[model samples]
Target: MKAAIFFERDGVLNLCETRHGHQVVPLRLEQFKVNPVASVLLHQLKLAGFVLIATTHQPAVARGDLSRNELDLMHMILRRKLPLDDIMLCPHDDASHPCQKPQPGMFLEAAFKWSLDLDRSYIISDKWQDAKAGQVAGCTTVMIRSPWIGDDHHDFVVDDLETAVAKIGLLQNNLYGREVAMA
Candidate 1:
């Protein structure tokens, strides 16, 4: 089984606009911009042998504000810029669509599809929904210090993506050291 790193798409991997104090997805392909710092941070995790997956909740599609083609175009740009192995999305507007965030469905689906060891995997996100999902999925959750990350339970809180990646590196190294000691 493989241990994967699940990243939240909006604020973590790319830049988005704020609407009423909430981070909202960009409406057009022209407005989409991938964060350059994400590449270096994710590359470090990739080199450590973790399968990188990006998970997102795009309710705008179901709400009729965003088209699937436009979303696909955005993801295409993301794939070209990031070291992501897969991009998982939930297009539903609510719990009626079980794959949405705060529901472990997307993470669970990724685990099944990628043969992931959920207990050993990690989730890096800037919002509370992803952290909640990660907790239920048995993955360690790391939350970026953002206003979107409300009062939530998380395994680690870091200032930025680089810091989060460093924490993951330490966790991986500590596990490796323990295994070597056991041997």
Candidate 2:
């Protein structure tokens, strides 16, 4: 079984903005600012042979805050900058959409498409919903702590992507070494 890595786009790969006192996902290409450490960590993970998949909840598309084309443009920019193998997005609100995060729909879809071993995969995100979804899907979940989301059901919590990546690297190395020893 091959291991994979899943990431949440908003707040993990890019900056999330607040509108009208409510936190909102980046809805436009201009608003899609890549986190400084995200690119470097992604490159490192790719070099380490981890399949990088982006799983995101883009409710803004369903809410008309952004068009599908705009979302595509933002992803294109991200793909150009980061070493991502695939991107799966759920463009539905949690109340109305069963596929949104905390549901594991996006992660299941990506796992099916990529033929990944969900048990051997890892998910890194800055949201509770993201971590919950990953955990439900049987992946090791890491939550990047933020003020908006409180700690609850996460496998691990870190300050930022850089630290998360380092922890993942250590875990991966230990797992791989143990496998080698068993072999």
Candidate 3:
């Protein structure tokens, strides 16, 4: 089985705006802006033999605020800009939905599809929901410090994506040894 790194969309991979302390998802193609730095950081993980996956909770679709086609276009742009292996998304508005964040359904589904070792994998996000989900999925949770990062279960907290990548590198080295992790 291979290890994977799950990245939260919106704030992590693409740029997002904060409104009243909450990160807002771009509703239109014009609003979507992929972060350039993420491309390089993700390439490092890809070279380390880890599957790069982007997981997101797009509840706006269920609420009828956003269309699937628009979301797909945004995802296409994200794929073109980032070295992501797969993008998993839940369009459910209900928190109880199995695939939604704070639930491990998406992670578990990815694990099954990719034959991934969750215990050896990691999750990077700016939201607490991903951390909660990662905890239940058995992946090491690395949260990017933000207003949405609730006081919940998380393995590591970093100030930025570069730092998060570095932290993951250190953890990988400690877990699998330098040569194995690099290979």
Candidate 4:
């Protein structure tokens, strides 16, 4: 089985607007802006042989705030810009839904479909719920320091995606008992 890195879509990959301490997902293609730094950072992970998958909880779609077609167009642009292997989404407003964050459903499904070694994998996100799911899913969890990152069980906490990726590199090296430089 191969290792994978799961990323939370909203703040990690793209720029998200904060309104009253809450992230506002882009409802239109014009509002969606991909982060410039993400490309180089993600390229390093991809070249290091980790399958990159994006996991997101877009409840706005379920609430009729965002359309599926618009979301699809955003993801298409995201995929074209980033080296992501797959993008998993939970467009449900129901919290108990299997694929919702704070649940391991999305991670488990990705594991099954991608033949991933969960133990060797890692998850990066700015939310506590994603960390919780990553822990339950048996992957090392790295939380990017943010207001939304609640106090929860996680393997590491870093300031930004670049630092998070470096931390993953260190952990991956330790797991394999070698110092493989992350380019």
Best by lDDT: 3
Judge candidate 4 against the unseen true structure and give its global Cα lDDT, from 0 to 1.
Answer: 0.93
- Tens digits of lDDT, candidate 3, 53-128: 9999998999999999999999999999889999999998997889998989999999999999999999999999
Decide which is better by lDDT, 2 or 4.
4
Ten residues in a row with the worst lDDT in model 1? Answer: 92-101
Stretches off by above 4 angstroms in model 4 are 178-183
Q: Report lDDT per candidate.
A: 0.90, 0.83, 0.93, 0.93
List, residue by residue over 1-183, the lDDT tens digit for candidate 2: 567899888888888776775567776678789877788889999998788998887777777888999999989998998999988888886655657878888878877788889998899887778777877899998878776455677888888888899999888889889999999
> Which digits, one per residue and each the tens of the lDDT, describe model 4 over residues 72-131?
999999999999999999999999999998999999999999999999899999999988
Better of 1 and 4 by TM-score: 1
lDDT of 3: 0.93
Q: If both were scored by lDDT, which would come out higher, candidate 1 or candidate 3?
A: 3
Ten-residue stretch with the least lDDT total in model 4? 174-183
Q: Which model scores highest in TM-score?
A: 1
- TM-scores for all candidates: the values are 0.96, 0.90, 0.95, 0.95
Instruction: Per model, state how many residue pairs clash.
Output: 0, 0, 0, 0
Better of 3 and 4 by lDDT: 3
